[model samples]
Target: MLKKMLKYLSSLRFTIVLICLLGVMFIVGLWVPQQRLLKTVYLEWQKNTPNLVAFLDTFGLTNVYASPVTITIWALFFLNLALVLWQRWPVVKSRITVTDAKIVDPVTASGYPFRACYPILPELSGDAVFAALTKKGFTLRGTTEGFYGIKNRLAPLAFMLFHLSFFLVLLGGLVTVYTEFIGFIDLAQGESFQGELGRYNTLPIPKMPAVGSIPKVSFVVQSIEPKVTRNTVTGIDVKLTDASGSTHLVGINTPYNTDNSSFVFKHLGVAPLFVLIDPSGKEVQGAYFKLDVVKGRQDTFRLGDFLFTANFFPDYEFKDGAHTSKSMEFANPVFLITVELNGKAIAEAPIARNGSMAFNGFHLEMRDMPFWVRFYVDKQRGLSILYAGFALATIGVIWRLLFYRREIVGSVREVDGVRCLVVAGRSEYYKSLAEDEFVRLFETAVIGK
Candidate 1:
């Protein structure tokens, strides 16, 4: 039963099926969006067919990669790999032993002749022949002659290492899926925020109750520098004040570390001013907007029935009856404002030079402009297992490429009272070269010219 099980596990067909299944799973994972809400997919699909959207969401296909079914498939793949290794190990070990007499025999019982025969010298014992074969680079082992002659016996073991590396990589991936969280945070110039531990950061909505629910970790912005001529921050200087009143400074590529908190300054942007007025025509509250050079226009805040948006121009010029921007350096900043009330256009105006847009007893003005700082928070899980797996894979490739086991064996026997020498060579790679070397060594030993 054990042998049958081993045979089944080590069969090439089994591995091929496992590999094909994994390939299908990987392609599906890539094509199907991962870690997204079913409601978002359903809403998108509702634009066409609400029924299909409901069906897809009901089946949990929106985030298939992280679904329990997909994870179970991957688990089976790992099990198959483990079984394959377990089944093949005994065969590999058996092949490593060279005691099989058929491998060294000169003549078959059917009288089929072998190649390159040499007369065995009387002075040369089987031990001497084995020693000569060793000199010729054949791996030999046994207490007595005719016991064993094996070369490249460990060649099959190379697969074991390769498979182990793959297993480690899979294990690391599982760890990442279960324990690690990834998210993005957007920080504008001079703006300070205590980021959530695992949430993707975006523009904070003013007066939103969810914004208040975010945990407060004391962070202060020191400076935000331009990464390029663009509006993005090349780097940022951050001062993190811990709960114990200890402050640590961190910058780009330099992380601030605390006992429970780790911070990395990721990105920076320009914070533009957005104002909203109440129904009584008084400025109630304003929201700060972070603008990216690539993102041209941003949505506005609503006050009562009026909506206001801000368009920022680093340097503005009029070309072909439209505003054109030259650079993002804020050399000449301008705002193109549009106000709408009750779904009707109220007034359109350009508010430049710290001015206000007044229409119908309403006043909107740029109040306060502050720079924003974006930082990432992380909790380390000791050493990253994925990185360690990658390291092991690199080492395995180097080992297989540079280190090859080789062995040669020569057996001598008196054939018609003539000294005959037979040599066989084996290597993990460059077998022909090993064979040539064996021939040369045997020629030198048998027939000295």
Candidate 2:
């Protein structure tokens, strides 16, 4: 059964199937985006083919690589490779032995071509032939009566080394699939805290503030020690507390990793707010009158239940009389805000650079912003396996490619009245070169006519 299995794996059919499968996988890799957010894909689909968005969502084709079906295909490919290697081992070993064996007193055949050129060549003594071949760039070794010479025996091993390298590459890929992870974390500037170690359902922020109340949902900043020389400091140290009453400290350069998940510091910014309440039992945040100053420019603000972020231009001019921002950059950030508690607008104000809005009974203000940081988390095990496989493959390639087994056999025998030198030589690699050297050895042999 083992032999049969090995024969099947090493057969041409199995190799052809493997090649075809690999080709399909390559096509899939090229056509399908490996990893992307579902929402992003949905949005793109909606933009292109709104009708098919629902259908596409039913199948997880957007992130093809992570999809269960794609992973299964990769698994099958690995299995095929393993089977092929297992089946070919015996044959490979047998060839190795045959190629390394020393040949001595090799029988000279009557129909040999070399004998036709020099009929007495085969009749020459083995020692004489060995000595002649050695002078012709062949390294002759073994006993005087039974000698061997070998040349360029390392060429055939290249195929084995190449195969080993390929195997290693496949293994590395498999390891990466299981062990590697990729995720993003968003952080605000000047914020310091050890990020969450495990996957948690809590929001990234301490609290979700009302639309316009930025102060209610601000980062807890401990301190800001500015560096005079460098563009950025090594890291900011901050403490974090979870609901379970655990505190952890983290820095910019030094992040916190738990359960193979990591949190990285990303960016920092401040969000200002304004609040307003009117007499009609309703409340509004931020005044609309302040919008006139940056009418043509971009405006961004959060109100009681709505968040509005927009770009503005200083020399605002619109083709259809609609005010549009000049560029996306927030050179002059402003918020012309208005808020309503129920159905009535109660407060209105203009929030300018580093300003806040307030209204009756409820007051809102801008506070210091914190740094925003990004983190990545993953739970794949294939990455490590793939790396290990790659290492093994590299070793295998070097062993098989750089090293070769060589052997030469020469035997002397008395034939007729002459001391006949019979040297039947074959090389696993470089057969032509080996034969040339053998001929040279025969030419140098002293023959008694």
Off by over 4 Å in 1: 1-10, 30-42, 58-60, 93-155, 182-186, 191-218, 229-269, 273-287, 290-294, 302-306, 327-332, 341-343, 351-383, 397-405, 411-421, 428-449
- Model 1 CA lDDT for position 249: 70
- What's the distance in Å from true for residue 33, model 2? 5.2
TM-score per model over all chains: 0.67, 0.52
Residues 1-449 of candidate 1 have per-residue lDDT tens digits of 99887676657777787678767766765665443534455456666876765665565555676666667767766777888778778877775555654344433222222135666556656566556555654565543233234444565666677678887787776654444333446555444455544434533321222212333465545445444366554555555555566767778888776533356776544665767665586667776766543336554656556776656665777679887677666566667778887878789776665677887877777665545555565533323576777777777676666666554444565567776765454555665565665566667656432
Model 2 C-alpha lDDT per residue in residues 1-449, reported as the tens digit of each score: 99887676556687677667657665765664433534455566567875555554445455555656666656765566666656666656565443324543455532222321233454455455556666555566676566656553443455455566666677666554444544444443334334343322233323321221111111233332222123324445545443345555655665554444444444333333344344454555553211212224444555555444433233233447554445433343444445555556676654454565655555444333222333443344344555665666676666654554334455565566655555665544456565775566554554522
Which residue runs does candidate 2 get wrong by more than 4 Å? Answer: 1-12, 32-39, 46-63, 66-73, 98-101, 104-141, 148-184, 189-259, 264-367, 379-384, 402-449
CA lDDT of every candidate: 0.59, 0.48
RMSD vs true structure, all candidates: 6.8, 10.8
Candidate 2: C-alpha RMSD after superposition: 10.8
